[model samples]
Target: MFKSVDLKLQLVELLISSYANVDLSKVKIIGVQHILETTHSMFRSLYLLGLKPENIAIIGKCYSTCKEVFEEMLDDGIYVDPSSSSYCSHKSYDEWFSLNIENFLTSQIDDLLSGKYEKILVLDDGGKCIKALNKFSINTNLIVAIEQTTSGYEDIRYGCFNFPIINVARSATKLNIESPMIAQAASERLYLSLQRKGLKTNKVLIIGKGAIGNAMKNKFASNMEVVCYDRNQKTYDQAKVELSEIINQFPLILGCTGKISIPFDLHSKISPGTVLASVSS
Candidate 1:
């Protein structure tokens, strides 16, 4: 749903085909995502594979703005709603991560402790479920986790793991195929949004020259002037010396850095009427 509809359909077909040979009857499937839309088809695929309704849970860790949309999708019966499935949206990302994730996973673990399922399989986003898993002592039944994002992989990479993890974040399929498509979609959306406002700009400043940033730069460069900066490059050359020196020059500034690319004090450096866009979650 995040990328091309064809790609999403192909992945779902692949997963459903592969699930035919697997025994997931006793494996409790727990899914976590920023939005419920991406995980809806996944839960449905598992159900089509004959996984029980009581054994599947697709929990959405979305924001307040998305709560209504989630409810509407459920109302529309967009996906198979298992008996154990539920979701809650918060006002901020930190609130959901620090408080809600562990609480939700704790309820699932309680079921595990009560001998409901032989094993737990997590579909994680942002590594929140894995981070929450570290708190429990019941490691034997927690078999595997699939992490979806690069930021999530980086967060859990140095941590001690008791079970096998599939790092889909670092997978070549995601890096080579998905990232560019996502970046291109993001770039076009931002450009179109600006166009609707009649705020056309020839120059764009892109922060963080990573895969997404580079792809976005290439996309924008086809029609506009684009300049990129990464923190890693600042130490090597004068051209990247200080973002503050050129912060006010560009009418459009895009942040693709996953971390904070602009400081609080530098907010004053941005010119009046400048448009700031973020491609990060």
Candidate 2:
């Protein structure tokens, strides 16, 4: 237990050191829900960098589980949308993401009683946080906004907002390691579901030759005969079967491309009991 906490502290140290040369003493940030493991470290690191406890406000209840969301020691100061004992009474996740959270946060931010913040942070994979901040009326000189989700990064990349966005979601290390592993896990979940349905088979069709697609191919190849596809000529040349011909032949089809690269025209050819999984956005 101590070892894990110690590792978290070390990561905090590294994060703090990244800004050691900068004059961040005057920066005031309001962090919303963040990944569970890093939230404590992030909160402590910001305070050590010279921000006051009151200057940092946190939102959201948990990460992957309810236990991770409702915590007694998670906050030292301002807390919004906290997962208290009555958390079950709060709006459902869909309702919160759609309007409740945006309304609540926007109301708090428009009023100075919540403390003026220069930045807002979020990781819920919902656009409401950004939408709320976009409508903020606080007196502080709000500069840039930061995000911690792949879908949020999609919004930034597509020019959804006018402000500068720092997408910590696709940090170089994460794109190279964390994301591929997560994609692999998705593939595993798909395989397990297929197994539960008594649909295990040796032949599989994997689309995309990118990191995630390739990872899925490798992870699935050991148990199944795998055929990979991509729009690129190089990838197509290496695959043993034509994309059009394999759709009807394979019992399982997975699209690993980051976008919708799978052809809808071929959907009609799929076997009746086909199992389809995708990691596309």
lDDT of 1 by residue, 13-87 (tens): 787887687766787877566444455445556666767656765556433225543554455443222222233
| TM-score: model 2 vs. ground truth | 0.59
lDDT values, one for every candidate: 0.70, 0.59
Best model number under lDDT: 1
- Runs of candidate 1 with Cα error greater than 4 angstroms are 1-8, 63-65, 72-92, 232-240
TM-score of each: 0.81, 0.59
Q: What C-alpha lDDT, on a 0 to 100 scale, does residue 252 get in candidate 2?
A: 83
Q: What are the per-residue Cα lDDT tens digits for candidate 2 across 1-281?
A: 22122335666688778877654444555545643445555565666677665554455533232334334324455354543222333655444444545555654564333354444333334344665666655442444667765655655466556556667767886568866677777877887888798877888877777666777877877888887877555255365555776678778888765445556687788888877887753
Error of 2 at 214 (Å): 4.3
**RMSD (Å) per prediction:** 4.6, 6.5
